[model samples]
Target chain A: MNALIIEKTEDSPGVKFDPATAQLSLSGESRPENAGKFYNPLLEWITQFESILFWRKEQKMDQKPLVFAFRLDYFNSTSAKYIMDIILTLNKLADKGYPIRVEWYYDERDEDMLDAGKEFAEMVQIKFDFLPN
Target chain B: MRHFNNPVIKIGAHETGKPYFSHTKHQHLHFSQNIMQDNNSLNAYEVHKFMSKMDILVAFTGHFDHQMITILLKNIRGKLKTTSPEMAIEQKVYCILVECVENVSKYSSGNEDSSRNGMFMLCKSDTKYTVITGNPMLNKDIPSLKAKLENVSKMSREELKQLYRQQIMSERETENNAGLGIIDIALKSGNQFHYNFKPLTETTSFYHFQTEIEINS
Candidate 1:
């Protein structure tokens, strides 16, 4: 599967997904006027990546674990809901015995972001790390 | 300075604080006294008509429903369209409205019916336009809110940018109700935020906030 990479803009975040390394990173503010247009494709890419990994496992091929890192400074309420959706997807994949790690990077002063990470951590079964930047 | 005669000062029996005039009373007296002296000058009715024509209404209801916020934003934006054409000013107004509306939803610790709702008013002078939002807040929340305001007030434009960057870089996974958006509003307005908390009831207080953005000629 081809790698999915999107550069961040003033209004949206940058997303980088490497299928070979199974590393995905999203960084920046995400408060687009039309959030669905921006996030739907990213969610689709994740699903596709999971499918490829599942097929590889069925064929007895060795595959690396996936690591997803989130670094967001500010996100609106609408974007928050979309983020929950993404985390849940990852949790589902992890539940199926796939090795997945989620890292939530936040600033020390932004307690809100930290709390948000903790809230999401409680909901998902995957190993979640909260890193202070 | 404009001078007025026969100003009306009304205070409820329980109301205190040197008997200051309410905004509504001030407007009425300003028109009534000025109309008798200058017949052709703007009267209270004319001002009301103009304000109504301008489609500006400051609604203060003690209810923090999400639906009310949506309705308020739509109405305020509609009024701004008729009042000014500057995109920057319009954006400031939008930012202020969003911040105030969200603050009410996030805070306002009172009973359901008595929940401290806010008032939003639009006033324009010859060269500038203003949007003011006022709401009730708990007395205890004032200190932190004031400190945040003071901290932001001291920062310059570049400093505020740096502060914003640092804030983003150091954000934690969770946050308390720390009035972060108020900083954004101050940055956008290019002005110090005006705020005050006055004791209302024993368990509640009225918090007033005002900010103005210049409409460049």
Candidate 2:
């Protein structure tokens, strides 16, 4: 599968997902005017990636588990909802026997962000790591 | 003038080249009415008028929603761009507005019928810029609200940051809303949040919050 990498901006964040490396990362501010537009594509990519993994298993293609790391410094209300959606999707994938790890990183001084990560962790069955930067 | 069971105060027009009045409810009401009327779209012009009329603006009128907040923020940014043009001041005002409006959108309890059910206002003067927001909150939530505000008020800058970080690490998250917006407001404003709760009924209270950011320039 081809890799998808998008850089962060003043108004948006950066996204990096390399199927070959199995390393996915999202970082920066995410308060876009139209959050749905920004997130729909990412959601689609994740779904396709999951499908590819599933197909690979059926065909006996050697595959390695993917590691998803979410590092958001600041995200608005709209983006928060989508992020939750992404986490839930990942949890489902993990439940289906896909090796996945979710890491929530926030600044050491940003207690609110830390609490946010904790809150999302409780909702899904996926193992979530809360790291202080 | 129209009168309602609730007391309404009105102040006269602004005095050119004169010091703006503070702590006067009438002035705020009058200024708000004029701004609302003049800016048919409630665009940047109205925000500019609002900033010019008051030294500290605290509006908690029930006219904010998601769409309205977008427009309000745009207008406020426009006003800041045209007037001060300082990045820091612009950020301060923007953060205060975000906190105030997000609270209203999250907690406003009035049903669909009441067009102006929440409280929203902006105040500004030479020394400070203030935003006051009011929304209907459940009576049961009052204690927690009070506690949070009290805790926030007591924290030093470093302590607040630590607390913010701690909250970030907690594993419990709300689906669509997080109370972090208020914390962001406090941090950006560098002021103690001023708030009051007036009972609207046995089940609900009008939660009022006022936050201010000083303008050193």
Candidate 3:
């Protein structure tokens, strides 16, 4: 599958999803004026990749485990909802037995970010590796 | 503390000679020169002292626009790093400020006759920081804004999470940030949302909102 990459901006986060490398990640701050416009493409790309991902796994051709890393220092609540959506989609794929794991990184000093990641970890079905930076 | 209905113009020492008030034909005086000259009592140094006593860190009042938002956020981020000891508290404060500013900017009527004017301030009180924002908006937007604020304010932590999830999954087009900005502020501030609306004119009103976040020591 083709990789989907979104460059970083002052008001948005950078997104990279490469099925080839089994790497999916989002980093930086996310406080966009219009969350829908910014996150819509990211969601659509993930959905497209999900279909191909499941189909590839069905063919018994699973190469490497997928890694989803979230390294956001600051994301408004609206952006948090979008992040949850991404996680939910990924968890559904994980449920299908496609090897996947989520890695959440936060600064050791940033308790709110850490708590947010932990909260999402508890709310979702998949377990997350909370890495403190 | 003083609320104003009409546009209050304060002429600085530099613009002293120019007519502060404008009239097409008649230059009839309304308030009087005595009140106009009373601004000599309003000293910038005294105002700074008062603001300092209240630990006022950031304050701005003007038109709300995209460029202004960016500049304000950048200034807040820089200021918070020095004032706040913990990164977590700084981040939370920044988040709340962003929401407040965005909310004010997003819903502002921006009418041609009377453009949307806004005021934003951040003050420190003991172990908490308060964000206060006010803007001129159409009176019609009040009901929906009130309903959303009341709903979020009433929700428990768990309920708020569920609502957030449902809203995102439904792909609803919100007024701003999918109407999730206010909810996010409430949740982060531990449900500290105080809002009021003052009638400014027949169709316009001034909306004031304040939220407090506990400074993590």
Candidate 4:
């Protein structure tokens, strides 16, 4: 499986999915006018990566911890559901006994962003490391 | 109806006790027109005094477009950096502004005559920061808007958080609309919304929304 890198736009976040590093990360602001159009490909990529993770497991090369990270400063109101969808997708992998956790980073000054991470934690079983930067 | 010109639009009666207003006389005085036109009711003196009373830091009212969002964002960033400056509060204002303007821009009706588009005003006082945005919207959208506002306004903080999570899991999302604007606004602004609706026609109305975020000491 190859890595996927989506450059960040003014109103959309950048997505980085690396097969070799076994980590996927999203960073920057997200406020797409058409959120479904922006998130659909990312969703497809995640589904495809799940199979690749399974394939990597078959190859006996799955020693690294698979991780996901989100470092967002601002995201639109409409994008929350899509963020939740990302978590539910990651939760499926966590359910399969994979060592996986999400890294949610927020500025030390922004409590609302940090609070959002806590709320997300309540909704899913996946381990989320809420880091204050 | 909001417009007195169209007397059939049953507005000023107040007999039904509906929480609605009629902007019949001031329809021409909308933000867009007030910015451009001079013949109507608004004047620079009154606008200045009004903003001064609110302690406004930044304000804009115009057609909701991509270029306008960019310019407004830049201007807002500059203002936040200059006045009542705090990184946390600035971030909060920016986030809320994005949501509020997008709520107007993304949901604004296709009607050609409504002069309010993504009209946003940000004001600061000793205790809190206030954000107000107005949009011209379709009458068909009012029921859901009112329901959402009423539902969230009544919920406690914990209850709103729970409902937010529940909504994410159960709702089917689309491209243009995700139906989370009011919920996020409520959650971030302490679950309170100051909202008003003024009918223009039987089918069109102007939706005005105001939010306050307390400046943490």
Candidate No. with top lDDT: 3
In the range B124-217, model 4's lDDT, one tens digit per residue, is 7777777878777889988977887888899887887777777778858455444567777777788645778878668877777888888874
Candidate 3 off by > 4 Å: B1-43, B113-116, B154-171, B175-179
TM-score on alpha carbons, each prediction: 0.53, 0.56, 0.80, 0.82
Per-residue error (Å), model 3, residue B118: 1.2
Error of 1 at A131 (Å): 33
- Error at B210, model 2, angstroms: 0.8
As for candidate 2, its interface RMSD to one decimal place is 6.5
Q: List the residue pairs that clash in candidate 3.
A: none
Ranking by TM-score: 4, 3, 2, 1
Off by over 4 Å in 1: A1-133, B1-60, B172-177
Local error of candidate 2 at B204, Å?
A: 2.4
**The candidate that achieves the highest TM-score relative to the unseen native structure:** 4
Which TM-score value belongs to model 4? 0.82
The TM-score of the first chain in every model comes to: 0.94, 0.92, 0.92, 0.93
Cα lDDT tens digits, model 1, B1-217, are 4222221222111342222323443464322333222534336675565345332455444465655655666677677667766655664566556666566655576556656465566655545555556566677777877788888888887787566544543433333224346666666678545666778878777666666656672
In model 3 chain A, the worst 10-residue window by lDDT is A54-63
Compared with the true structure, what per-residue lDDT tens digits does model 3 show for residues A1-133? 6788889888889989897887989999897777778888887887787777777767878558778999897887678778888888888878877777899999998777887788788767787999986
Q: Residue by residue across A1-133, what tens digits does model 4's lDDT show?
A: 6788989977789999898888889999887767888887777787787787787778987467778899998787667778988888888878986668889999887888898888788888988898976
Each candidate's interface RMSD (Å, one decimal) is 10.8, 6.5, 2.4, 1.9
Rank the candidate models, highest lDDT first: 3, 4, 2, 1
Docking class of 4: medium
- Pairs with steric clashes in candidate 4: B1-B9, B1-B10, B2-B199
